[model samples]
Each structure stands twice: as C-alpha cells, then as structure tokens.
Target chain A: MGWFSWGNKNQDISEPSRQNRQKCWETRDSYFDCLDRANIIKPGDEGNSCAKEKQLYEDNCAKSWITYFNQRRVLADAQKDRLAQAQAQADSARK
Target chain B: MREVSHFVTLMFSQRALASLARRTYVGGQQTARHGRRNFSQTLKRQSQFGKDRNTIGTLTPASAAVFVATGVGLYFYFRYEKQKLLEEREKERSSRQYGRPQIGGPFSLTRSTGETFTEKDLLGKWSLVYFGFTNCPDICPAELDKVGTILNKLEPALGKTFLPVFISVDPARDTPERVGRYLADFHPAFVGLVGTYEAIKGACKAYRVYFSTPPNADPQGDYLVDHSIFVYLMDPEGQFVEAFGQNTEADQIAARITEEVARYGK
Candidate 1:
C-alpha cells in the first residue's frame, strides 16, 4: 500500500514550477552520482563544474541549475579541504 | 657621555634607596602594631626595652596569665585561618572538576503525551537524550532498544528513575502522535519529543547533535537521514555528563551509567 518511503511522501510537487525545480535538482544529483560511479569525479578532488574541461554535460543542464549546483559543490569541497587540513594538523600534533 | 651615564645611574640608585627606606619604615610600623620583631633590629630592641620596664621587678601573676591566654588565642586564630584557606582551595578544585560542557538550554517542544515540554521541565531529574528520526531504518531502533534495556536493568539495582527522551530531528514528518507510537514500542517510560523545525534545530544545537536530510531524495523512493548516533547523558542540573556511541554494547553502557549515577548520588 505504500508506494514510497513515508519520510519522502510529503514533498510538495503539486505546482508545475516547483515540479520543474525538483526535477532540475534530481537531475543534478543524478549527474553527480553518475560521475562519481564512473570514476570521472574522484573523492577528495575539488568538483568544479565551471571549468571547461570539468563541465558535466553543460548543454543538457539549465544554466541556473548548473550555477547553483556548482556553487554549492565548491563550498562543500572547500569545507572538506579545511576538515582534512585540520585532521592532518591534529595527527601531527598527536605524534 | 660617560658623565651623563654616571648621573643617570646615580639618580636611579638614589630613588631605589629612598623607596627601600620608605618600605622598611612602613613595614616597621606594621610590625610594631602586631608585636612582630622581624622588620628592624632597632625597633625590636626598643620594644624589648619598653616591655622590660613593665616587668622590671617581678612577673605579676595577672600579667603572666594574660600572656599565656594571648598565646593560646593566637595559636587557635592562625589554625582557623589556615583551615579556612584549605577549604576554599578544595572548593575551587571541585568546581573546576564540574566544568562540564555548556550544553542543554531552553527549548520548547511537544511531548508524546500531547503536552508541551521545555528544558526547564528537565531540571530535577537525570535525562538520557537521543536525537534521531523515527524513520531511521536500523540504528535508531537498535540504540533505543539498548537504552531501554539499560534503563530497565539499572532501575532495579539502583532504585532510581531516569527520564529517557527521544527528540526527533525530522520534525516535518514526525508529529507528536507518530513519535508517541514509535516510542511506545521501545520502553514504557520512554518519552518522545517533536516540535517545529526551528525549535528542534535549536535543541540539537544546544546538545551538539547533528542531522541532515538527504538532498534530492526521491518523493516515491526509500531514503535515510544521516546523523550522529550518540546517546547523551544529562545530569539533574540539565548539564551534559557524557555520551555513549552507537557501537557501545548495552551491558557496557549499563555499567558505565550505573557508575555515573552512583557518583551523581554522592
């Protein structure tokens, strides 16, 4: 009787505009997941969709979506780098 | 240039000597009032000469008795002052030991019983708080089971009751009724808390718990929330004591909590 996970069942997809936004976000996630699965984007590497060589099917993705996803990814990657650097420092201090 | 250097040195020496003399005079005055004889030999000799006149002929019995009584009084006075200082130092050390992390604060939430609960309500009793959503597939239920079992075991042995609290991070889906139903399956004494997203977030921040909803989750697909899986032990004063990680066994957790509650009783 349950078609989906109860936690995700309440997502607002009634409005067409909201549906488009959700679709765009899902597509971006899929593109990133595909890149990750294909080994095109390695873990711990800075994901820069803005780079011409790094663009993941830019023609298929909307420009606004691409910009939004790239900005968020860059911020997350920067935070990861900081966390790694802090971990290294702590390791050295422990030694 | 040599004459100027000599002049500066001479002036500095003069000032230093003057300050030393002033300090000695002040110290001598205080020593005189206290009948102490350390400041200056000259002052000591003068005090001894004056006392000798008072006792020139023979030691009066009244004066001898007064002297002995004053000596006894001085001994007790110094002993009492030393004891007070030691007690103050011990107090400072214990306060530093109780320097528990600043966690737990005012947060308005709804309990499973359709009652409003706040951090103030947790004032008088020790609480075991865990932050996780009811939809958690495995870890949340397993952890809650461990907590319930530990609480049950500890109660009979220690004869003490502890508030077992479950605060949901997924407030949007976890209504008070949903939380109530979920907790009912765990422990009879267990309480479930839910609130608006902002209120729940505030509580999480106060407790240093972290949770995030997965991004771009399918509306019609299975999903999981990523969060910290630690059961926080809060003392009666609403202060964080320690936390038990997910991997900790129920027996070990019970032993640890028993030791903690015993220590808390003291």
Candidate 2:
C-alpha cells in the first residue's frame, strides 16, 4: 500500500506560490483591520460587519493560514496591552 | 673472635651463606680457621669488584631507605603508564562505537523536479535539511531566508560541496510543482522535496521531526500544523552531524558547517 503511493500522480493539492502568499497576507491584514475597527478581538466575533473583507481573506489564504493569523492577531493585541500597562507602571515608579 | 661471629651472623642474614657454603665445599682440604680466613678474603674480593657491592655489605639505614624508595617509585611509574594506555584505548574504542546518536536512516522522497530522491542521494555532499510547509506564513519563510543567507556565506569557501534542502511536512498541499515554485523565491540551489503523507512521515521519523498534521484531515480545513523547527546538517556519507535550532544565527550555522567540512575525512 505504501510503495504504490510513491508516485507523484496521487497528489491533487498544490501549495500556494509566493505571490499567492503575499495576497493572502494582504487580505488577512485587511480583514484584521476591519475586525479592529469593530472592536472585535476574536475573528468570528465581527458578525456581518466585516463580511466583504472576511470573504476575501477566506478566499485568498489557505485554511491553516487563516486559523494561524486569527490566533496571532488576538495574541499580538494582548501583548500590546501588556506592554502599555508595563510602561504606565514604569512611569509611576520613576515619579 | 666476637667480631668474626658478628660478621658470620651478618653474612647469614644477607643470604650470602649459600656462596660461603659453596666456597667451603670447594676448599674441603682447608682447616676451619683457614675457611674463616677465606671468607674474609672473599668479602675483600667482592668489595674490590664493585663499589655498589661494598655499599651493600655496609648496608647503612639511609642507603637501605633510598634503595627501597627507588624500587617503590619504579613500580608505581610503570603501573601509572599501563593505566594511561588502557584509558586511551578505551576512549578510542568508545568514540568509534557510540560517539554520535543514531539520527539519519533510509528514506525515499520526491524532489521538486519529480525525481526520486532517497537516502543514497545524500551521499558525497554535505546537506542541510529543513522540514516546513509552503503555507507557513512567517516562521517557515523566515527560516528559509536564513538558510539562503547561510548558503551565501558558505558559497565561496565550500563551493558546491554543501546542499540546502527543504522537505515539506504538509504533503497534502505541498505538491512537487508547488514546492518548486515556493523555493524559487529563496535560493536557486534549494531543492524542495514533497511526498505522500506516509512517505513524508517516514522521512520525518528518520530525522526525528515531529509534526501535528492529521492523517485524514480535509485538505481545505483550516487548521495549523504544529511542528519542530530545526535544520539538520548531514555529512557526505549520509550520517547525522548536527542540528541547528530556530534561534541559531545564520553566521553561527555557516561557521559550524565550514568547520565540520574542514574536519571531514581527517
């Protein structure tokens, strides 16, 4: 069963090219920006507000990439909040 | 007479009585007093032959101590030398037997050109292998770029001796043509490999790579694959040499590979 599958003929899926990946990132950024304007930290929480941008994001990017980017967006926002809090604490300490 | 008896006692204590008895047996015609005179004469002859023999006859406490110390020192010196030789042999044997971990093994995968690539293809050239997917947005691209930098650094000194390879862990999406197109952005020398899921799994197992790609997952499903990010360096004989982590700098990897190539076949 394993030896017969060694041929490349069985592979039906093709990976994204460099240009496709760039488009995916652009669409992802646009979608995330829309989510930010709607005050939505989670990707699915934007409801029908960012529908056009979300459709482009889903179309341009791979499924796995969309998932990763969505998770990274929330994490990056949390990290930004923590950094701002730390800065405020440091300023109070200096005074 | 008392002095003569003391001399006789000293001769017996030093095991010289055997020689004295031989002399007495040889001169059986002589009287007992004549035999005693012969023993004193024999002692004088021995003293005249060697200064060391005369010193032994005197046998002072300080000289005896020096003799015993010399014997003990020589014994310990030879013992230490023997021990050192044994340890050196053991070190050599161990290095030949188990110095490196068993990492690389037989694997068959497809190259970007749709050619069959096996473990035998890794022979006769140094190879740096990375496992990643083309869909990886950040980490894989960043690592491939770093590999490009390393290759640029290694080109002049190493020439065509080193090969940079990228094998896709996400075989469901990474077809040969797609892998080729993806690698075209990094470096012209990069050889991208893709295979069936089972084939990719076998290659990963040979290199001890871990990936969290479900076997029967839908190709269109949106799920990120969690995988170990490392670059494996294989020697010319297809043996595992070293592994560079994600945090290792390109210059460091290049320097290490240059050093390893220089040390090869010596």
**lDDT score, candidate 1, position B23:** 45
Over B1-266, each residue of candidate 2 has an lDDT whose tens digit, in order, gives 34445544664554455354434444553433434565656655554665545343445587467656755666676678889999999899779757787888988999999999998988988998899987677788889989999989999877988788999988766778879988999989898988889999999999999998888855554456788889999999998889999899999999999888887855
DockQ of each: 0.04, 0.29
The digit string of per-residue lDDT tens for model 1 on B8-92 reads 4664564345334434454554433332234245444434655543442323477557656755666676678889999999999
Residue B195, model 1: lDDT of 85
Q: Which one wins on DockQ?
A: 2
iRMSD, all candidates = 14.5, 6.1
Tell me how large the interface RMSD of candidate 2 is: 6.1
Which candidate's TM-score is highest?
A: 2
Q: Which 10-residue span in candidate 2 chain B carries the lowest summed lDDT? A: B26-35
lDDT of each: 0.67, 0.78
